[model samples]
Target: MQKPEPMKDQVPWATIGLVLLWYGTNIGVLLLNKYLLSNYGFKYPVFLTMCHMTACSLLSYAAIAFMKVVPMQSIKSKRQFLKISALSAVFCFSVVLGNVSLRFLPVSFNQAIGATTPFFTAVFAYLMSNKREAWLTYATLVPVVAGVIIASRSEPSFHLFGFIMCVSATAARAFKSVLQGILLSSEGEKLNSMNLLMYMAPIAVVILLPATLLMEENVIGNTIALARNDIKIVWYLLFNSSLAYFVNLTNFLVTKRTSALTLQVLGNAKGAVAVVVSILIFKNPVSIIGMIGYLFTVMGVVLYSEAKKRYG
Candidate 1:
């Protein structure tokens, strides 16, 4: 008898475990990030982002070169490395801006803003790939945009700085997705997430360190000394980096076992879960209109994902 296909015929227990791992880690990272950024008064987003990129680069190198968790696939030439560098530029901004946003906004509100990423994804895909969506798909963006507008208006603790940074981060993330598809459509250029992480994370470090130096007042050395003195800060920072790696790893695992659309759907669901958990943990004062608006945006994303599955 022929072996069953792994993607189509997943072992039920294994799939369930992976789903739980992905969900738990994704939520855990967000909360921890919020705590470190705002609640704990460790307000150095650029440096924190630098740390994450540094850890990601080191961990990814080990996975590709030493652990052999994924077969190593290095970029072939200068042109290819340049493309990866461009991708890294956007990714670095996305993460740093995202961390910056968490410093001012409640996590619930932040995730509500993030739920609009599919709207930006639709826009970026058209510009980058010249790939147009169906009229219905275009129409679906109305609710996503409108919901966010309403949610932002009613968010109890709205901060203009956080709002702007969150929106920028969402747009940057969408751009990264579209650009990666356009840049790596070739079979030879394709790298699994770990290998991609190995290359992109280091490039991001190169792009971010200068920005951290220019924008952040605290030197990297000073920050490290401070974190070392605080035992809890040290562990949280380390755990955060480890959690970041698991995030990328599980994203690859889920997409391989299931489909990209399934992962997208799960991402939407995760955003919703994160929002609810944030409200509970932070006791954020969300109004009824704000709640309704968030629900609308999330539902719109679900619809958008389904439409993409069919028409995209």
Candidate 2:
């Protein structure tokens, strides 16, 4: 028999669609979060995050069960459930803190702080697992840290508490990512991103409920009062929560279709798009130095992604 030629790779329209969908949902949720927390007078971050997790839990179930988007996964053991609950706790902490920070910080400056996630990730990896990256990879983080410093100094609406919360949220997010890998590294314990979300969402809701009740005084009463005043608040919560689920779904779909490096690069671009959109929509004042600093951080993120891809 004659040897056959291999087929060439075609343009990934599906992946492209997924990436665009991811961006839309991600940015939509971010903008809505800012609007709800800052402008809309919904100051309960834990409650807002609870709404998101509740939506995720319900949507994930429907997608897996009725829509058949992916095979349904169940917790195999108590240990696995515990691990997922731990992750959910961390996830809730990061999300609640991020939302809280949004109340006091402009989305652009917040995103600038968030762009330094890789720096935290690298640090956590080394501290937790003694993992070391190439020198170049570490060097790329210099600009990442420096940019935040410059932006913080120049930000017109800088709030120290918001900055601290954002940085802590970023660190907690990095820690969760690292912890997930450690907790689920074994083949038997591993779950796909969808399944992970499915499991984590409900647990996160459980974790957030008590915290919301304890930490946010009269949140339920306030929400009810707000709804009585403006029924649109309910609609906003519904829409924002739905967007939250889609954000996770599209993110997993995009990563599944493309390389993680591609997702990271796309994320860098997404942050810039978000910053621009938020600036236009919220009309938040941004100094020239602040913009320059954000650009530097984004550039550093891109370089870090490239360096990680090459070195790893």
Q: Tell me each candidate's TM-score.
A: 0.93, 0.95
lDDT by residue for model 2 over 161-268, one digit each (tens)? 999999999999999999999999999999998999999999998888999999999999999999999999999999999999999889888888887888898999
Superposed Cα deviation of residue 185, candidate 1 (Å):
1.9
| Best TM-score among the predictions, by candidate number | 2
Q: Which residue ranges in model 1 land beyond 4 Å of their true spot?
A: 1-11, 221-225
Candidate 2, which ten residues in sequence have the lowest lDDT sum?
253-262
Report the C-alpha lDDT of model 1 over 99-161, residue by residue, as the tens digit.
999999999999999999989998998887788999888887888988999999999899999
Candidate 2 clashing pairs?
none
Best by lDDT: 2
Residue 285 CA error for candidate 1 (Å)? 1.2
- The clash number for model 2 is 0
Cα deviation in Å at residue 57, candidate 1? 1.0
**lDDT scores in order:** 0.88, 0.94
Q: After best superposition, candidate 1 residue 190: deviation in angstroms?
A: 1.9
